[model samples]
Target: MLYWWSKFVLLGPLLRLLCRPTIEGVDRIPESGGAILASNHLAVVDSFFLPLLVPRRITFLAKREYFTEPGAIGWAKKQFFTGVGQVPVDRSGGSAAQAAMSTAVRLLREEKLLGIYPEGTRSPDGRLYKGKTGVARMALEAEVPVIPVAMIGTDKVNPIGSRMWRPHHVHIKVGEPLDFSRYEGMAGDRFIERSMTDEIMYSLMELSGQTYVDLYAASVKEKAAAAEREAARSDARDAARVPGTRAG
Candidate 1:
């Protein structure tokens, strides 16, 4: 209810005016049916933008943090998410992620469009990382077609740490529906599962124009964090060398 209300009532007019998204193959998305809208996670705004752009009421798996925020901000965040028809998914990995996948399958069975990010998280360095097999497993088990939608230039509008939105245009490209009919009932095999996931990622790579990374997002994030710390320490040391600057 809230999803439609917000999309058509609240912010629809302004969002449309600001972002005149040029869509290609909009007809590719079925008018009414169950399928997976798998896309590369590029920005936090991807959730809002993609859902709004698509004609269907696409359901995205949102992070648990949005539901766990504090104070008035928390209340508003909850309302906004609920309005957009987002499902709460704990992204911490392990058991929580597994449970989320299970719920996703249930939604698929109901013949609804389920949006998932095969790459797990937003590309840290604007590069498409390896996709997790979870997406493949879901599609095979649910027997649904996967549509690879790529969102580019959104990271610039709302990058990782920047708290302001820049007046830059964002582009979204929707690829043809990728059929996995040959792999029907093959989710049980780990090898086939990985291969299917890779095929989806390759389509997304062409759509989003992001460099492909062989490593996982979590590992790369850890290394990036460590590098930032080292750089910070080096900067502090250099500052201390100046006259009158406090030093250890």
Candidate 2:
């Protein structure tokens, strides 16, 4: 399979020799069964790292673009994702948010390990954001355990838009499974979903130690973008005033 082949034969070996992800509490992950590995996304490589460490095959909900491509490269990519057990999720504009959830639910129903980033996206500054309630809903609906995975130092290994990866010691701390059997048969209840989501976020917050933003990362990115525009304008003015430089 492209997934495990690419990971074990390619990325896994390279990362092991390079980034050298240090794992902790790995025993927390259930050796078998369909449970949700709810983790805080830190870097692009976060997905790559976690799978390598976990012995069992884990699947993730990735953007649909990853699956929709053309030609040999595209085909290989599709094969890779499929081999690794990733599903195509449409998280772009003009799509309903629930669309992503629907696909994920189907995966859970199959009794597979559904790896979800509770923060929805990778943390811009490696700080954990408010987890979307979808993880909770899936756990409650599927009657499965929610495993919290706290990833540290991955952002430094591969930054948000970095073209290269640095050799850094990363940590993947797998937390004990959070039992939600008490909420069995209460999946459709809105109040139960919210409460359970909050509980999962709390555990993630403790594990990540990133300032928990009550708002989603998308909102935070918007604010950050606005700030960057303002800073860019200021820098442009400063660069224009350099001596002997023409303002063409």
Candidate 1 wrong stretches, greater than 4 Å: 233-248
Model 1, 149-189: lDDT tens digits are: 99877788779988876555777889999999998878779
Worst 10 residues of 2 by lDDT: 92-101
Give me the runs in candidate 2 sitting further than 4 Å from their true place.
Answer: 93-96, 229-248
RMSD of each: 2.3, 3.0
Backbone clash count for every predicted candidate, in the order shown: 0, 1
